[model samples]
Target chain A: QQQVKQSPQSLIVQKGGIPIINCAYENTAFDYFPWYQQFPGKGPALLIAIRPDVSEKKEGRFTISFNKSAKQFSLHIMDSQPGDSATYFCAANPNNTDKLIFGTGTRLQVFP
Target chain B: IAGITQAPTSQILAAGRRMTLRCTQDMRHNAMYWYRQDLGLGLRLIHYSNTAGTTGKGEVPDGYSVSRANTDDFPLTLASAVPSQTSVYFCASSDSSTGFDTQYFGPGTRLTVL
Candidate 1:
């Protein structure tokens, strides 16, 4: 119930391409979902997040699509840039909890 | 730094050796966490403290311990390191006052136990 499975262990795309990374969880108690972006040698930073209450949320060039019924969520990068090449993580947590269960991670590489 | 910071950016230790990885945050967030990132195993929480004086165990708490002396610092200690403990460790902080789930992470400490 604590696992958040992420797909496409690694992904590669050209500039301006769209890369979608998917994550699915087995626990329905998870209410908050957040996506983090990490560059090589840097800590993962909050790129964007979404709640189960919403079907989708967009920020700048990143978007999170949530499927509450399917217990899945995904991160999509629009107009991918070389700078977007990094590892992305999707995490989830139950309400009123401080611990977040993170997916293995998706390594994204965008080439120019 | 304006956010969280970790010490000894990278370290290599002999098996059974003791090691301590430091983490400090200037945000003064109410909650702090320690996680180990391993390939194919995502980030697993090792320990967490909701406040300065209280602490709790997470998914993989064995072989590791943590202390939150004050809101600004949370350190993770390895009593006796093992080869399996080799991985990247991250320290994160979040404000518990709000229901938001945002956790600010530190640069991370890369530990390799041989």
Candidate 2:
């Protein structure tokens, strides 16, 4: 079974727009949530991360809104630009283990 | 610094052939991992090593094997190739001493089996 689930396999947005990618998980034991960005032919890189203790965290134009009770989390990109186009993946890791369970991923394309 | 390096940017192999995918890290991380990325399936862990000389199976370990003889190298081997094994493989490492440490990934090696 897929421990983490992501929606909208692909997304398209215009410059200056806001793009949102959402993910849900079934394991409440997961305490760490992180997002990764990957360009074509490259490995995924960490963008931002959040712990369940906080409801939201922001860094630059990226923001992670997490809802512990809902077992859901989302990534919001403000002032989206063409440079932001890439595949985004959400991952959850249990507190007891270092292993990470990743979501299917969302391919975002920001048009100029 | 070279966080991690994977050998053979891409490879094409025939079924039943044996192959080895190499991975090396320069950060002296305590943990290393092997993952395969497929379309729509995201990235799944194939194997992992908590420290030198200790390895464990991850979500998918069938037909794949790994060994960590030192802190810098963790190589994955395929005894026999199969078409279904075609995917982009990545190697990652982290400092396990730090709780919830971020994983750094390699450029990845794309393997195609026929």
Cα distance off (Å), candidate 1, residue A27? 2.6
Candidate 1 CAPRI level: high
Which number leads on DockQ? 2
* lDDT of candidate 2 over A1-112, digit per residue (tens): 8999998899999999999999999955898999999999899999999999999999999999999989999999999999999999999998778889999999999999
Candidate 2 yields a Cα-based lDDT of 0.96
Q: DockQ of each model against the real complex?
A: 0.85, 0.88
Docking class of 2: high
Listed for each candidate, the true contacts retained, as a fraction, are 0.85, 0.79
Q: How many residue-pair clashes does candidate 2 contain? A: 0
Kindly list the per-residue Cα lDDT of model 1 for residues A28-75, writing each as its tens digit: 488889999989999999899888889999999999999988999999
Give lDDT: candidate 2, residue B28. 96
- TM-score for each predicted model, relative to the true structure: 0.96, 0.99
lDDT for each residue of candidate 1 in B1-114, tens digit (9 for 90 to 100): 569889999999999999999999998799999999998788899999999999999999999998877889999999999999999999999998777558999999999999
Give the alpha carbon lDDT tens digit for every residue of B93-112 in model 2.
99977786999999999999
- Lowest lDDT 10-residue stretch of candidate 1 chain A: A25-34
